[model samples]
Target chain A: MEALLEFLSFQDPSVRMVTLGAVILTASSALVGSFTFLKKKALIGDAVAHAVLPGVCLAFLLSGEKNPLLLIIGAFITGWLSLNIIDFVTNESKIKEDTAIALVLSVFFGFGILLLTFIQHGDYAEQSGLDHFLFGQAASLVGEDLIIFLSVGLLLIALILLFFKELTLISFDRQFAQTSGLPVKWLELLLTSMTVLAVVIGIQAVGVVLMAAMLITPPAAARYWTDYLPRMVLLAAIFGAFSGFSGALISYVSPAMPTGPWIVMVATTIALLSILFAPARGIIFKMKRQQENQLKILTENILKSFYHLGQKHQDMKHRYSFDEIHSIRPSIPKPRLKKGLRVLEKEGFLRKKENSYRLSAEGTEKGKRVVKLHRLWEVYLTEYLYLDPDHVHDSAETMEHVITPELEKKLEEMLNYPDRDPHDEEIPYT
Target chain B: MKKKILQADNPVTEVHDLTVTYDRKPVLWDIDLTLPKGSVIGVMGPNGAGKSTLIKAMMGLLPLASGYVKMFDEKLDDVREQVSYVPQRGTVDWDFPALVKDVVLMGRYSKIGLFKRPRQSDKEIAMDCLRKVNMEAFAERQISQLSGGQQQRVFLARALAQHADLYFMDEPFVGVDMATEKAIVDLLQEMSAKGKTVVVVHHDLQTARQYFDWIVLLNTRLVASGPTKEVLTDELLAETYGGKLTLLNEVSQEIKNKEFPNREE
Candidate 1:
């Protein structure tokens, strides 16, 4: 805890720079990644990240120094080239986009590794610790390294603010954007450059190998939280910045922990948690909705069965024992049937006295609607769709719980307010 | 407004020698046509016959092999604001993070231009368009929660918000319900009455006579193009359908099922 406080409190000047650098790089990348993820071009971000390596090494080889500005320029060149190459290859041949991305990513990254190795072996001065770019040495960042992030982050945020609507429209509906005369080709170039810029600066903290996760994972988590793009971008930036902060702090506490891989790990955990526990779109929420729907169907089925028994005995207020209800609905097991009976009773749909249950007034009306919808569907199907009455009963049985009041009315009007269904059975009415 | 007849000058859109291909397979071939002003035109064709490609080509979406499209007898770049496009609903990822109003607000972005925020007046216009489509109640609702019919209506609202003189709709009626289809048809007729030329890529021959003032028939080639009453004869339809009545029947059945394939590709 002391180490964490010390790391977060920025007692060490280097710790402050690393944390700030990591946060800015990641947050900007997350903003750009939201658009890429939405465009379903997520893997393109991965390719661009890997493609930046040769540029960084070539920048060092040409300049003979590790100038952050020069390295960024070099990285931008090769990164921009990589995106164009992918586009050219996909357009010129039958090679699919995924295939082209994989091809370009491997070749560019392979060339970068070769260049990096050459730089390490060359007689260049001040080349110590250059291999840190491979896995990201966030702990090694100083005031100069922070410049790469600050400049790029400002440019990214500024462009995102200025071109948010154009960027969004083109990403969501390119054909419409083109027809609307938004200078679509120029917008695509702008977006591609932004993607390249985001990847170039982000690689310093997240590293080449794990930089793609820095771009994609945060947005994936943010999507589960909201259906608004601006809010999603904000959430993704927070998630990305948090991962970056945690990764930098962990390495600050324990020097052996590599910050890049750790950042990827933390981001992946957030995405998994968001997938499982977030509200509305999350897995747990969807499962809960499914369970609620099943319970509704079960309770409605029990009420419908009770209503049928009342009709058979010519008494609406008759009380029935569990065995009698069970006898009518032999499909339901005893425990489940009893549980449903209690649930209906608790819902004020049934009156319970010594385990014998009778339908309440509201429950009677609810039960009648279900039965009415079923019979109304039956009459419509046989009368309109010409389905056999026997076959129609099974369909109407399912549609009973699904139909709304409006649909029930439409069915009645379409069937001409029929009292008797095709089966010659009395269609129950309220 | 009276029904429109195509003339040589002052056409809403004129395509000459336009061809499009995918994987070297020709989707459209030598398609030369002129659409009239203030008319509801229906482009009818079979699957893979480039009904969508035709509109896309005119909108400058597809790279034409050897042709040009003139809007209002002028270059497309000059008259872009006067034109609007509604792509097939299925072409979009409906799960996009946006509300109904946000999507409609995009219609005004062309006018608002680059690097500027939409004003309150723009919001009012978007809301008015939403109300026209009977979707004002859903302005705040996220788009993913809507049904296919509602989504189609939302797309219509977005197009209407553009306030363009020429509109191109790619299969707008495909997945919509009967009532929604009627509403859209009414909206199109109203637009035509107000002197907007609308082109729709349609598949239902049953409603072709009732819905359109002009028809452009195709089967990978220009089979016919003229007024609906003159061009929708059994012979021209047979030629456009190319003796594949069985498949046409199956496709028409699919339309009735509200599940037609919106695009050839």
Candidate 2:
């Protein structure tokens, strides 16, 4: 952690420039990625990331050197062609979309690997740095490379902001977008081109193998944190920028670590965290809510049990023993008895009269509501769900605590205000 | 029913011998229909009958194999401002992370032109349309959280925000609840009463007679089209539904054969 702070405040001009460039590129990639993720084309980013490898290698082979302009052109051509081919194959042929993506990804990547091997054994000695494209080396981004990255990154951001509405429409509903006379086809083409441009631009920094992760993970993580598009985009960009900067810093501090893998690892870690810790949708939060609900149900059931015992004893001064209450509800454990009784008494639903419990006036009313809801649900289950008379009791036994009062009334009305459940037990009135 | 063109002084949309094909196979063959200036027209057809293709062809969304589409005596492109379209519910990804307001604001994009941000006026128009659809409360809500009926309303509100003189809706009632269906029909009726042309691609045969003032029955070709009372006879119903199962089987077989040319013994 201290090392990270030192790197951030480092006086080195070269480190500052690299950090700035990484931040810009990462923000640009995540902005584009949000739309692509929303469009349900997350896998398309993976395909394009791998598909640009051959173009990069071919440009390197033909030019016999690493020229940024030629490489970007070649990468764009290949990426665009791969997208078009995927479209054609899916439309004209019976192959599914995943298969089409897999086909193109493998074919392009295979050819790229072949070219890379040939280059490794060929006469060009300056091609040693070219291996960085396979997996990124953020430490090597210099003045010229940084300029190209920043310019493309800025162009991408500008296009996204300018065509924000059009892209949103197309991503959400292409058919509607087209019918609204919004040029759906051109917008789709533009979006795909922008994604390709982002992938190609980040190849030297994030690398081909992990470029797809940068495009998808940030948006996926952002989705857990936000429901709105603009916010999602902004959050995704922040996550991406953080990942890029940390990855670059890690590589800068270390002697021989690559940037792409560390960046992906960090981004993926953030995504996993969001999936578990997000306020509404996270698994941990959902479990917590369920546990609380179960606790409420248990407490309510205990109160209902005390009310029933009080009515059975038929003495205003009656004090039922704990073992007797437990006998009525055998499933409840001994540990919960004290807690349930204390909660019932605190809520004015029960009274402790010398080591025994009796239902207060409020307790009787509350118990009646629960019993009414349970019996109504049983009737509903028997009538609406077509469950056998005998099969309804167990399920309604569990649902009694959760059904709202409004639903209980509707169920009563629907069942013609039944006075008794399927078990021939009298349903207490509210 | 014999074809008879309306003698209105100014019709909102007129399609003359409109033919559409996919890869040289005819999907919609020679359809001649004219929608009057102020009416709610329902286009009904069996599955795969090119009902949606007809709307797309008219909107210039799909290429016309052979024919012309005129809006208010002008070509479709010339009168694009006067037209709006709503596609089927399933044609888009609902999980798209756009707010209800943002989706509706897209209706003003063509009017706003390229490279300009939607201004305050555009947002106000969108909000008004949302109010009309009873979805004003959902303006800031993400579209994924909405029910099928609410999604349809939002789409309708988007089209309404366009304020186009003519609206083409494809399967607008698909997946919509009965209440939403009633609300949308009522809205369309109000639009027609106000001298707007609303063309909808509908599927429910039961509601066809009651909801629409005009009907166009299609089965890869125009089977019958006219006022609902006159054209939707028992004979036309037979023509639309009769032999449908056999036809579907044949089409499926043909597709299989085309996909696998060497499958035969």
Instruction: Give the top-scoring candidate (DockQ).
Output: 1
Question: Worst 10-residue stretch by lDDT in candidate 1 chain A?
Answer: A140-149
Check candidate 2 and list the clashing pairs. Answer: none
Which candidate number maximizes lDDT?
Answer: 1
lDDT per residue (tens digit) for residues B1-265 in model 1: 1112244344788988886765444567688888889999999988877899999888888877677899898998899999999999998888999999999999999999888999999999999999999999999999999999999999999999999999999999998999899999999999999999999999999999999999999887788888898888888777778654465445545643554333345
Cα lDDT for residue A135, model 1? 78
lDDT of 2 by residue, A276-338 (tens): 999988989999999888778877898777666666776533678788878888888877877
Worst 10 residues of 2 chain B by lDDT: B256-265
Docking category of candidate 2: medium
| Runs off by more than 4 Å, candidate 2 | A1-5, A314-318, A336-365, A375-399, A404-430, B1-10, B22-25, B243-265
lDDT of 2 at A67: 82
lDDT for each residue of candidate 1 in A22-69, tens digit (9 for 90 to 100): 888889999988888888889999999999999999999989998989
The predictions' CA RMSDs to the true structure, in order, are: 6.0, 4.2
DockQ of each: 0.73, 0.57
Question: What TM value does chain B of candidate 2 have?
Answer: 0.89
Interface-residue RMSD per candidate? 0.6, 1.7
User: Chain A alone, TM-score for each of the models?
Assistant: 0.95, 0.89
